[model samples]
Target chain A: MSTIDPTGHPNVHQTAAELATGDKTDTLLQTDGLRKDFGGFTATDEVDFSVDAGELRCLIGPNGAGKSTLLKLVIGTYAPSAGSIYYNGRDITDLAPHRRVRRGISMKFQVPSVYGELTVRENARLPIQRFADGEERRRRVDDAIAAAGLTGYEDVAASVLSHGQQQQLEIGMAAALEPDLLLLDEPVAGLDVAEREAIAERIVRLNEEEDIAFVVIEHDTDFVASIADEVTVLHNGDVFREGPVEEIKADPDVQRIYLGDEQ
Target chain B: MVANTTDGAGSADAGGPMDALRRRIEGPNTVGNSRGFWIGFTVAVASLVAYPLAVGSYQASRFSLFLVYAFLGLSLSVVWGYAGVLSFGQVVFFGIAGYTFGIVSVNFATPLGITAAFLLGVMGSALVAAVLGYFMFYGGVRDVYVTIITLVSTLVLHTFMAQTAGDEWTIGTAALGGFNGMPTIPTLALGVGGAAFTFDSVTFYYFVLALLIATYLGLRAVVNSDYGRVMVAVREDEDRTRMFGYDVKRTKLAVFTLGGALAGLSGVLYASWGNYVSPQVFELAFASLPVIWVSVGGRKTLLGAVVATVGIEFVRNSLGGEWAFIAVGSLLLVFVLGLPGGIVPWIHRAYVDARGDATASNPPEAETVEVSD
Candidate 1:
């Protein structure tokens, strides 16, 4: 015990070291004091977050809590005004969104990004072919198609898919990139119970089998509780609380935020 | 995702023939892929190669001009079609490259080899365009900025050429031949056996045809390459392209320079055929014409651009003089308004539709089941 350095507690140090490795290590992503401002308005305050390898983390916040803005910042869709983001132990704070995707990160938008003019498979394949090449690309695309539960509906135009199916197809499109980290912005935001469960189960299964780290943003508490290993609560552009699902649900602050103080 | 689910259930129940039709339309292909594309390509090439021989000398000569325009249109297609950059000043490169050849052969030296002159013209135009593209593309210019910069640049070059045509230290505007253009510019000479043949109308037709074929094949190769894919991706989403580890500006500049070189090549051919190089070549009217050609043709398809050029030229040549402009202009309006996808895409669509293959309208179904959470 005396021989072991006190500064480097094995369990805590290992976790920290693992996180420090960023996207390459067991930690898929890490954000440090990320901030975003729009003129005089602060859209996202300094935020520190990390997603472990193959972990499914859900971000929950009420309206105007800056969840989407935070996601945009993470993807480099918006430049953060302050702090840094690391992917694969590389500082990617200033990288472009597409570059981030190319670096093994892919995101599904809150609204599906399917091309109405193109069929579902074509829409998926366009990005796949754009990003991938040779046999690996073909395999990934085929795998993603199957994974999305869109086996027989590939030829259907994206515009023609059911709402649930569209979301699944979008996930398939993102999955085609074979990303290490998948960001889902309210993937089940507007789906029915069955559809929500279907998507949630898919996310859990993908996490387990594909070993993909996921940072999901959703307002639905039940949905977040269902899939999340860790829940980060955002409130008014700042993190209100963060912990395990049970701990987050038990927090009085979170309950007050959701049900109001009087209640 | 939950909020909108209930609304879609009613529609799901009502799915009838439309759903069946949709399923049929969405099914996978049973036939092989390579056969159709190859057959179509072969037929197209055969038509292009045989047209001049079938139609005789005068029509063939006209076809040569059409080929030059096709090159010009293809040049603009890479810029406007694949890269989503609109250039109204492409004719400047054409004019410049033509002038380069004319000046080199006429004033500088009469015996300057054709190959040497052509190489010089192409290189010079490409260099100028690359430099210009660097400024325009990397300057963070978009839509209006691109339009104004290119337009102003063309006007500046045109005026400069007009003013400098007859200077004492210069090649002398007389050498440039001013507005009337240089006449009797020598044609390419092909050494056959122990003798050389002066490229006459028929010979020049083949010469231009060879160049056209080369241009078509070369451009096809380029467009099918990784570079071409990047260019298309840039066109689809520039921000996304940039994020994907590509310098969008560099890609744009490369496309622009390549396009310019092709345009210059067309210019060289035009100068050779017409035996002229004039400031009028750089004028706004001529500069804007190729854009129309690309629009009237299918933008993404190289074959479509060539076909449109030939088709438009044929329409113009048949009508004769002033009436040709009116007739062609009216036809252009009809093509632009009614057939925005251009003749080729429309024809392709009609052919596919007439074949009555349901899967023709959709993509193949997914084949496996990997994840069902």
Candidate 2:
């Protein structure tokens, strides 16, 4: 039931249920001189970045600073005009979006990503059922829903969930694939302070327990400070700063442009 | 609500194929499935079988044409309503298949010929859809553009077919017909020579009705299956689905091609019924008619599509001329505005509400959704 093969790339399928989890030193995802230009406008201009296996990283940027664009680039939503993306030690720059997903890369959108009309179980089942079949699929779906802290809400329609719960459902759906890496775009954008804390806690718990590497694109400094072990700051389509979370938070340029402005 | 789909435990693992099929037919993926829904379905099907007993031979024959259109309606309902890919010109496939069946069956005029023609017509339309779907999806033609491209395809076919009036436009014994249309084509049949079983009006009505029932149940099960979940996912959000590891273009292509085959099946019936084929079938009015049928019936529900197609066409035939247009146009407005889920789902909500939500009766994690959206 392996939908993708990370070893050879290009949707070479093999049973991957027992896929070896790489050590933490392994760079799960990296971009080398990745550049994206929309007609004449460059959204992410030749930025190099990398994340280790099981790392929890946050990307912070001001408006038009390419945080979202970089995430899209990594997920194969946007093809870079120049440069390449490497995943699991293989060059995956030309891989299709679905192929990338099969290679254990999943992304949750900035928007309300839940299939609002589908029930929580249906939403959860879509990703798990893609690769896992029958009883195993059902088991994983139940596990993922419960893992997202939404076990009892399985029968409820996703649309009626509070804004924060909806986000958790989307994350749950994203995690149902058991992806090695998950990219989240503005996962806490529309939530309240308490709601944001709930989401942040969920993200961190998933990161440690599942050993799933995460690169969350957010503009919230306090949120990032709480959850992310490492942080990357972007400005004008380039990596403006990258370091351990606290050091990056203390970076003057980042505070002046993003954190200071937010305050 | 696509809600009860998660509770796979209810189907009882030790069922036979017939029981499995029954489970699929009565599955929670579709809008219907209450005990009341099945009872109504049995009653409705029984009535359809006995319909000719009440009406004259002419009315029965006329109603068969409406049954033919239900295939078209179901085609659109799956593609547009369930899959969320609104197609404005499903009838183009109908025309394509009708012409193919008319041409092949006319030249051979035998049971084997009709059988071959049926296969050719369905496969031919599906092939066209596959090719067109490939370009539209893979080339990044999305949303309204896909709708526009389909509409343009129908218009192109119409303009081209309408001009094939000359002697050079004949395919063997069959003429391309141009605007004049092909007539005197053989009716549908099966088996070879001495054993050939041909259909008259009453037989054909029963035959297509049986076919419709099988198709409906089969499709309900398909949508409730794992693949159906992906189809719904693709419909809900293309990009998000892609991120979930589905090659969405392939899913869209497959659905579009299936839809084409369904519309093509209707076309084969249409040609067999009338013994005629015309470029007028590809005209904008015919092209846009299925959209209205599915929309007014309930785009999301198969029952809605079939019922709406037959009921609306009957109403149109009875009302006649400008009055029919006014009535259909008015009905469409009412459903599109007031009851966007369409008549069947709307009625379904009332029934479910009256019965008190199905999940409310369940023992655990009971949640009721008022499905207004």
Candidate 3:
């Protein structure tokens, strides 16, 4: 028998039952029966999503599939209209953006948001200052800059950097905070193959070396397959399909909805 | 403040002539410590110190009035430039301090009374700013709304004060004299009880100059601190800064209150110098004057604000009549249209370009190589 639950998450009853029964102990971030409504319109409806500790996950969907909105809900940029969000096994659905940062969560937006007027070093210094001070602040800034492959451009203003470099600097600055989980929206979107490869390698290195969990939103299937351990596909704000990268790639349903197959 | 800005690279790297030149070009621009800045500061100080000796007492007294206005410009620089709070009601604090000092000094007519007036006037300005800032920031008022609210408040104050000319408007022993203003307000003096000695014109000029120097240095230290860095960051991007874990509202409130206190202190000096307090201090024209000076000089740089204030005032005094206003108004238009970054940034840009040209001849040990886009 098919059943519809009122709370919005496509399988609210099943998800709530699983959560109540403590079926997901290793989850670092979990959103159950999540729904977001704007006025009379529903933007994110009945979405259940989770990321495991030390896991690299990719979220993919067609345009208006509510992928970005889901990320905002997780980062507390957009308050969920309904449902609960738990991080590290504790409810943190109402924390403000800064409080979330203090709890070791960081995010990079689709457009590079580095301070254009500030020097590259200054950009690194701002986020690093929150975590370290004295000589340690300098060391971390240097390390982040080096990791981003921007050592020589330290004194130059961030506005002069090319698009890909700016994105690198944003990731490098986020890394300086030493966050436990990182959420990047379109990190390598619109870059050439070389630039895309450079950023992909950096992300893989950071995930493996620092043991940082990432939920990257991307449309590039090849890049996703290279980095993402598991993939989540959303269609009209419902989890259409989710599985290992290869299985999701082979799924005829995902291909029809996301891979542009005509019905 | 700027104490941690530099390492002793000069002594350690005291080597070839090329290294010496490069080091000189990159010296710490802390307070008035850069080579060019130090020279200009010394020259200005010497000239001001030698002014009373060179000019008549009347001229020196007039110059002292210009010094008072310089404080107004600096106050605006702190509030508007660093913190990004565009307050059109700065004259509100200035007027409060002037009236408060005048009323207390006239009513009590004692050293303790004058002291009480100064403390209360400055503190009262700070308290009012704190309350207003908290409401505006916490209430989530838009930036344009904040500016309009402050401007409207100034107009309200001017209209209210202008109506208080009646004899019924007496506070304690002092009358609110209305648009005609309260004349014969007591001058500031040093000493305890009633034994205070009044300062002569020359003495007062130096006293005010000393206060100006101290204020300039104190503000320099403030804007150089980590607090100052976060303040500039807030100005650059408020939401991005908030996400980075800084309390944007508290920083705005603190800087706003600090700016008010500085204006209040400036007002006390103005009241003392003029020996009068007036409702006209809250007038719209008076309120707009400091904005003009700071924008013309360069808002981001404190020295630019002071220099613009003093230089423009000196020309205004020389030109006399309404020509001063006309000249200042024309100059303000030119600056707003042509040099939006203001004079200081323009000068810094020119200096950097010249340095870059010089360094182009000899490649640096590590040059910035652009990565592939």
Candidate 4:
């Protein structure tokens, strides 16, 4: 898959992949002093965040934490009132949502947003149709549907699908974009244990085999531990803790703020 | 060997040549796709053609006026149905083009002048829609707010035009006759001096029918195309569609402008057909008619818009009294309450149910997976 090295200023000497490959530890996404205020309330405040290329990171937080807001800010759904974002080591704070998508950053919302009237095949085809067509488009759509475990429900309208299936279809739609960075807001929030396990494995394979970076906003701590290479815990618009999954899992403060609050 | 592999399969080509024809008409963007629907479509077109032949030229000409309004219905259908932008300003664009056509045609007073007016009127409406649509979509005005803004825009245009009856309101040779309307404006014409061809009463009626058919089928092809699929996707979920690398605002703007242009065509024809242009075109009562037509018919189906427009307009013209409004209003209420999907889809659902088609409301077989929250 081709990658868009979005630095806002094109004609840079080095491509994004080259930078990632050269160091093998270079940050793929970073935010500096990022702040977003909704009137009198601030959702995300003065946060410093980063994600490495091909890394699978989990963002866990208590209810009302700013994880989703941060994801929205990164995907250009929410404009930062202050601070900036850099992708591939260059500024991209002002990029529009669709332009960010073209630059290989995209997200699935917390809610199921599949086209209820459209079939599973058609829903997967919408994002894929933009970049590929004919045999390639068909192949990508097929892969996405199968990845979502929706192979037999190809012709069925998305509305009739079980809630878990609808959420899975949304994941399929997002994955069909084949972005460099995929941000999922509670992707497996509504799935059962079996479905959740299947989705976790698929996401891991995507990260490992396809080299797609992820920032998954999740509530399930066990699910997070199963997949996250690194974990970032957010509480009340601040990055409360950041470390490897084991470290996050063991942190007492993280437990008091997030893991312990699991009710 | 490959050809022989599935040779015993329970299928045969319907004349082999017609197989390709089957695919284009029945895409996922539309509601009606059954063979029964196509047979009904052919019969309807044949009846339309035969009706004019049976009637006198005057009656045919009057019926053609009904055809002119079909474009307005189709315009609203594209904007509100597919693009998910509820607008009452379809008539605003129509009035603009009608007045523009009248102004330009009167000033030039030549065959070429009439041709220029056609281009100017249609393009003018599209240009206005582009400007207005830009402000609405890009400026973050969305949903029912778009409906309000468009409705206010229509009434504003109506109030403004109604006051343009004074002497200062004249544009070149044409007078802004205000509520009185501009009368005796030259009808639509084509070509150059000596080689000019004019659309006479009979010809104009035929021309309008032909144009309506072409526009309907052309729009069908459009709705079934990839772009139309995107339009439907946008209507389904704007944010989700936008997240998938689509400039959602631009998509809405394009469809809105196209709708404006279609309404402009109707306006141009209306001005020429009646040899008059009026502020009455933008009157609240008249302006709201396209909404009624589209809603009572199926807004999602282009043919529904056309059918409802012509059918309602025919009854309205014959009724000629307050009874027409009451009837149309009652019909609109009935459809809105009983059949919210509108006539075409309602009939289509029945047809599909009767056919036992797989692309429908059937329970999934076996292997039931538990739904989770």
Best by DockQ: 4
Q: What would the per-residue lDDT of candidate 3 be over residues A19-66, giving only the tens digit for each residue?
A: 563645567788888898888877789888888778899999998888
TM-score of each: 0.78, 0.91, 0.86, 0.92
lDDT (Cα atoms) of all candidates against the true structure: 0.71, 0.83, 0.78, 0.84
Off by over 4 Å in 2: A1-25, A259-263, B1-18, B358-373
The order of the candidates by TM-score, greatest first, is 4, 2, 3, 1
Q: Report the lDDT tens digits of candidate 4 across residue range A112-210.
A: 778987877778888998989767887888899998888887778887887778777887788788888999999887678988987798789888988
Comparing 2 with 3 on TM-score, the higher-scoring candidate is 2
Give the CAPRI rating of model 4: medium
Candidate with best lDDT: 4
- Per-residue lDDT value at B202 in model 3: 87
- Write the number of the candidate with greater lDDT, choosing between 1 and 2: 2
Quality of candidate 2's docking, in CAPRI categories? acceptable
Residue B219 lDDT in model 2? 88
Ranking by lDDT: 4, 2, 3, 1
lDDT, candidate 2, B161-205, per-residue tens: 998888999999999878888899888897788998898798888
Residue pairs clashing in model 4 are A190-B373
The positional error of residue A19 in candidate 3, measured at the CA in angstroms, is 7.1
lDDT of 3 by residue, B13-70 (tens): 4578854543433322223334455567779898999999999788898899899888
Model 3 Cα shift for residue A56 (angstroms):
2.2
Worst lDDT window (10 residues) for model 3 chain A? A1-10
